[model samples]
Target: MSFHKYIFHYRFSGKSDKPLILFLHGFMGNIHEFDEAISLLTDEFYCLNIDLPGHGKTKILDDDCYKMPKIADALINLLNELQIERCFLIGYSMGGRLALYLTLKFPQRFHKIILESASPGLITDRERLERVKRDEQIARKLARSVEKDDFRKFLDNWYNQQIFGNIKNHPHFEQMIENRLQNNPKKLAKSLQLMGTGVQPSLWDKLKENKKPILLLVGENDSKFVEINRKMFAVNQLCKLKIIKKAAHNIHLENTFIFIENIRNFF
Candidate 1:
C-alpha cells in the first residue's frame, strides 16, 4: 500500500515459491482492468496488477508524473522495495510501452515480457515535439473545459480512433474501456498529455538491442497496431507476434478466452 510515498494499489495471487507476473494496465486504465485475465492465470504465477499514477487508487505525483520514464522509474523503485528480485512483466497498450521501457531500462529485474497492443514511442524528435504540443493543448483544454460528460466525450473520440474504430456493439469490450473511462476527465486528459507514450522517448532501438524474449499480441481488426507489430517483429528477432482472431484493440476483453489462453501459454 505505501511503497515509498507513492501509494500504488495492487493485487497479487499465489505463494512466494512461484514465478511473479506483473500486470500493467493501459492509458487511463488501472489494475481492475486485468482482474478477469489475472484470475485465469494466477494459479501458476504470482500476479501483481498495479494502479499506475493518476489513475485508479494511486496518488498523483507532486510534479508532472505523466512522463513514461518517470512512471517507469517509480515502478522500478516499487519493485526494489518489494524485494522482488525478478519477474515476468506484462503490459497492454500504454502498459506495454512502460513494460518494455522498464525491461530495457533494467533488464536483469525481469525474466520474460508480454506486450499487448503496444508500440515504441514516437519515431522522430519532430513527431515527439508535435505530440507534446498537442498534449499540452489537451491539458489546457481539460482545465478550462471540465464537464460532467467530458469523460463520455473522450471515449467517443477514443472509439473513433482507427485502432478501436472497428469495434462497437461488443458489450464486453465497450464495458472494459467504459469502466476505465469512468473517472475525472481532467485527470485522464492531464495524464494522457503528460505521461503518454506519444510524448516519451522512442524505444525501437532499445527493443531491437534487448535480448529478452518478448511476445507482442494484438487483434486482427486493429490494422494500425497490427502493421506496427509486423514491423517490430520483423526487425526484432526476439519478438514474437500473435494476432487474435475476431478481436479488436481490446483483445483481452473482446475475446477473453483466447486472450487468457494465449498469455497463459506464453507465460
Candidate 2:
C-alpha cells in the first residue's frame, strides 16, 4: 500500500499545477522512451516517467514483484508517494497491458487511459496455456543469453520479430537497441516469466466494466494488435481505436509526431 517502500526510479517534469501524465514504457525499455513526447507536452501536463521493475534503473527486490498485479500495486504506491490523486496514463506495448490491468483494478486512480499495441490477455484457457508455453520458450532463450552474458543476441532476436519490422530500419534503431541493451537480462527474463501475457489474467470480460474513457492506439502495419483492438472496441463502446498510418508495434517511436498529435487530440 505504501509505495515509498519500493525504490522505483522516476523522472517528473513540468509545472506542479498542470495535470499529470504517467508514462509507462514497454519491456526492455526505460523511462527515457517518452522523452520526446514529454518534451512536447510539458507545457500542458506534468509528465511522470517511471522505469518499471526489471527494466531501466529500477531494481527488482522480490521475484513476485515482476507479476502483473504486483507491478500495478507498485504503480499505485508510486502515485501515493508522488501525491497524485488522479492522472492520465499512456502505456506502450507491455506497459500498455500493465496499464490496462491497473485501470481495471483501480479505475478511480486514472482520468483517461491510452493503450498502444496492448491486449487484454489470452481469452480461453487453452489459448492462455499456448501463450504461456511460447513465453516460456522465449524466457528460456533469454535466460540462456543472460547466462552467456550476451544480452545483445536476445535483443537482436526480440527486435527481429515481424511485429517490429517497421522499427528495425528506423534511424533511431541503433539507439533503441543500445537503450534496451542497458537492461539487466536476468531481471528481464524473470519479468517475462511472471508478467508475460500468458501468465496474466484475462480482462476481456471486464472491458465493458471500465468507466473511464479509453483510447486504443495500434499501428496499421501491426495487423495482430489492430485486430485485437478492433475486437476490443466492438465489445466496449467506451473505448476508441485509432490506427497509426505506416507504423508498426511501437507507434510512439515509429511515428512520434502523429503519436503526440493523437495524444493531444485525445486529451
Candidate 3:
C-alpha cells in the first residue's frame, strides 16, 4: 500500500489474534532480513515485516518522504490501514532509529520496543553539523556510485567497515550481499541524503520521557554503539542494555542464535 508518496510492501504472518510484532530492517536491508528470526517468532506472535522506503519491494514516491519523521508517520498510517491497534517493535540499526522516532511520536501505539545498534542522534549542534557534512559526503559518493552503476563496489565498501568485520566471513555473507544488491541505488542515495542520522532530530532528551519497555541490544565488539546504548540505559530505568558477547554491528546475522534468544526473552 502507498502512504505519503511511498509504496510500502509488508508481509503479515501467523494468526490474527496473536499479539503483533512489527519487524523493521536496517539500512541496505529488506523484509527478508528478518526471515530467519521471524520463522521462529511467528509461533508466539503474529509478525508484520515491512520493506522501508527505498528498500526491497517498497518504492520512494517523493524525496521529501525520506525524512525520518515522515517515514515514521507512513508506517503508522500503514499500521492503521492494517487495523493493527498496537504491536511490539523490533528494529535493527537504521530501522531502530526510525522505530525510536515512531515510539516517541506516538508512545501509545507500541507495547514494547527493541533497538539493535541504534542511536538517538547527535547531542550537540556542533556534532550534528559535523555529522551532516560527513553524511552528505558519503551520500554524494553513493550517488555517484549509483550513477556509475557500480553497486557491487558500493556494497563492498559499505560492508567493509570495521564494524562488520565479524560478519565478513559468515556463510551467509554472499547471500547478504546479493540481497542488498536488489535495492534501487537512486532511492538508496536519496534515503541517505534525507534520513541520515545527521539530519535526524536528536532524541537524547526524550529518552527519559519514554514510559514503554525498551530493550537496547548492541554487539560487544561495536564499541561506538555499545557506549551509545549504555548512555541510553542510564537515563531510562525502563531501558535494558544487552551486549551480545561475540558479535559486531550486525548481531542478528553474526550471532543469530543469541539474537533470536534475546528477542524471545525480551518480549
Candidate 4:
C-alpha cells in the first residue's frame, strides 16, 4: 500500500495480539524471503514482511528513496501508518545493515533485533569507494541480464561466491533461484547501486552506544561475517552472537530449522 513516498508490497500474518516481528529481506530478496521461517514462527509471533524499494512490486516515487536514510524514514513512516508503536525486527544481509541503522537511529521504536550474516558497513573511506566501484560493475551486469537464461547464469555465478558457501548444493537451490528470478534485474541493479553496503554509513562507532537487546546470527561456514559479528559482540555488552553450525551466508535458507530455533530462543 501507499506509505508516503513509496508504494510497498507487504504481507501481514498470524494474530495481531501476538508480538509483532518486522522482517527485512536481503538484496535481491522479496517479501517472501523469510516465508519458511515465518511459517514456523506464526504460532508465537505476528509477522510483517515487505518488499523494499527497487525490489519486488514496491514502487518508489523518488530516486532519493533509494538512499539508506530515506529508506529508513520510509520504514518508520510505514510503522506509524500501521499503528505499530514498537516491534521486534529480523534483518538479513542488506536488511540487517538497515535494521542496525534503524535501531541506532530510532531506538525507541524497536523492542529487539536479530541480524543474520550482517555487518556495520565498511570502516574506511577507501574501502567504501572501492566497494562502490565493485557494486557499480555488478549493477551493470545485472542491468544487462535482461533475458531469463542470462539472469539464471548471473544467479548461478552469484551463489558460487565463497561467502554463500555450498548453497548451490541445497535441494531447493533451483527453486530459490526461480523465486529470485521474479525480481527485475534492472530494478535490482538500481537497488545495488544505491543501497549497497558501500552507500550505507558505517555503524561501527554507533555499536558501542546501543542499549537495545541485539542478537547477531552468522553461519559457521561464513567466516567473514562470523569475524565481523565477533567484533560487534566485543564492542557491545548487550549484543549476543550465535554462530549457526554448517550453514553459510544465507543461514535461514541453508538451515531453516536451526535458524528458526535461534529466532525462538533470541526473541
Candidate 5:
C-alpha cells in the first residue's frame, strides 16, 4: 500500500490526532515548495505536502488525458494507500484549480478548501484553446533551454507578465519561485501542455452550486483572478474571497503573513 508509486514525497511525522492538512503544488512545482510554511503548520496540524504526478518524484501517469479529474483520481488513490478518509486541501495556481474540482466532485472528502489564484477553468472554450496554445509554446521553450532544469530563464519569462513581474523585487519571492521551478524541464513542460490550467474544467458553475466552505485568495492587483474571485463571492453563498494588498498571483510567497492570516481567519 505504498503510495510512493504515485506520490513523489510526503511530509508528516508527528501525531495523528490533529486535523490532516494536505498541500498540493502547482504545475512545475513539487512538495518542497511548501517547506517554509509546512514546518510552521506541522505542529498545529499534520501537514502532508505531496508531489503530484508529472512533478517532483512522481512518475507521469500513463494516460494522456491528465485532466483535473484524472489527477484527482491519483490523489484519491494516494489517500487510500495511507488510509486517509478526508483532509483540508489547499492548492495554489494549477493546484488550486484542481483543489476546487476535487472538493466539488467529492465534497465529503474535504473539510475545507483554500484556493490561491486558482480557477476551475477558463470561462469559454475559445479562451481555453488560446491559453493551451500559448502555454504549450512556453513549455516548448522550457524544454529547449532549461539548463539542467535551473529554469531561471523559464521563470523570468513566466514572471514577466504584468502581475508577476515584480515578484523578483519581493524579499522571499525569488527563492520561493526558484525552489518551485527547480524540477525537470521536460516534466514541467509536459505537465503544462498536457494538464495545464486550460485543460481543467470550469468550476464557476459548480462553485455556486456547492455548499462546502471554499476560500478564494488573490492579490488585490492581480486583476485577472481578482475579477473571478469577486464574481464568485458576489453570487456564491459558501465561498469567501480575500485579497492581499501589494501582491499578485503568488500571494502566499509575496505576502505570506497576510495569506496565512486570511486562511486562518477563513478556516
Candidate 6:
C-alpha cells in the first residue's frame, strides 16, 4: 500500500474471522521475517506482516516517513484501511521499539503487544547524542556497501555483536544473510539515520501511561536488553518480562519454538 511517499509491502494471511496479529520485523528484515512463526500460527491467527520502511520491498518516498512518529501514523492508517479496528502486535528489535511507540501512541488500536529485544530509546540527551554519532558511523558504512560482498561482510559483522549472541552459528545463518542482502544499503542508511533509537523519542516517561498488557521478551544471552527490559518491567505494572533460555537479541531466529510458545501463551 502506498501512503504519501511511502510504499509499504505487506502480506495479510489466514482467516479473516480469526484474530489479527501485526508482525513487525527488526532491522535488515523484510515482511518474511516471521514467516516460519506465522506459518505455524495460521490456524489460530490472521497475520499481517509488513516490510518496514527501507527494508524488504517497502519503498520510502520521503526520508521523513522513516521517523518513528511518522511511521507510526502510517501503520495506523494501514490498519484503518484494512478495516481492522484492533489487533495483536509483535515487534522484534527495531520493530519492537516501533511497536511500543504504536502501542503508547494509539493504545486503542492494539489489544496486546509483545516486544522482543526492544527498548524505550535512550533516556537522556547525552545518551541520545552519543548514540546518534554511533548510528551515523554505521550508516556511513552501510551507504558505502554498494557491492554485494561489501554488504554481506557488513551483515556478518553486524551479527557478530554480542547482543546477537551466536546467531551466526545457526544452520540457516547463510540464508538469513542472503535475505538481508536484498535491501538497498543506501536506503537502510537513511532509516538508521532517522529511525535509529538515538533519533527516536524516549518512551521512558510514557511507559506508565500504557493501559494495555505488554509482554517483554529478552534472550538471556543478550544481557544489555535483558537489563533494559527488566527496568521496563519494573516501571510498568501491566508489563511482564520473560528471559528466554539459550537465545539472544534475535530470539525468534535463535529459538523459534519458544518464541511461538510465548506468543500463544501471552495473547
- What's the TM-score of every candidate structure? 0.90, 0.95, 0.95, 0.98, 0.91, 0.98
Candidate 3 clash total? Answer: 0
Give the per-residue lDDT digits (tens) of candidate 3, residues 89-146: 9999999999999888898999999999999888998988888888788777777776
Tens digits of lDDT, candidate 4, 16-52: 9999999999998998899888999999999999999
In model 2, the worst 10-residue window by lDDT is 1-10
Instruction: Give the clash count for each candidate.
Output: 2, 0, 0, 0, 1, 0
Question: What C-alpha lDDT do the candidate models reach, one value each?
Answer: 0.79, 0.87, 0.86, 0.93, 0.76, 0.93
lDDT of 6 by residue, 13-116 (tens): 89888999999999989987888888889999999999999898888778888999999999898888778999999999999999999999999999999999
Residue 66 lDDT (model 4)? 89
- The residue-by-residue lDDT of candidate 2 on 1-267, one tens digit each, is 235345888888999889889999998899888777788888999899989888888866688888888889888977887788899999999999999999889999999999999999889999989988998888887777764347887787778787885687898887888888788777788888899989998999998788889999999988899999999999888899998997999998888999999889998
**In candidate 6, which residue pairs clash?**
none
Model 1 local distance difference test score? 0.79
lDDT of 4: 0.93
Q: Per-residue error at 136 for model 6, in Å?
A: 0.5
User: Over 4 Å off in model 5, which ranges?
Assistant: 1-7, 61-65
State the displacement of the C-alpha of residue 20, model 2, in Å, after optimal TM-score superposition: 0.7
* lDDT, model 4, position 141: 99
Error of 2 at 73 (Å): 1.6
Question: How far is each candidate from the true structure, as Cα RMSD in Å?
Answer: 2.2, 1.7, 1.5, 0.8, 2.2, 0.8
Candidate 3: global Cα-lDDT? Answer: 0.86
lDDT of 1 by residue, 1-267 (tens): 553457777777766677898899887688777877877776777888888877787776564666677788778888887889889988999888888899889999888898899998879888888888877776766555466466556566667777874566676656766676655566767677767756777898887898898999989989989998998898789989999898878787778889888777887
Q: On a 0 to 100 scale, what is the lDDT of residue 59 in model 4?
A: 95
How far residue 2's Cα lies from its native spot in candidate 4, in Å, is 2.5
The 10 consecutive residues of candidate 5 with the worst lDDT sum are 1-10
**Candidate 4 Cα misplacement greater than 4 A, ranges:** none
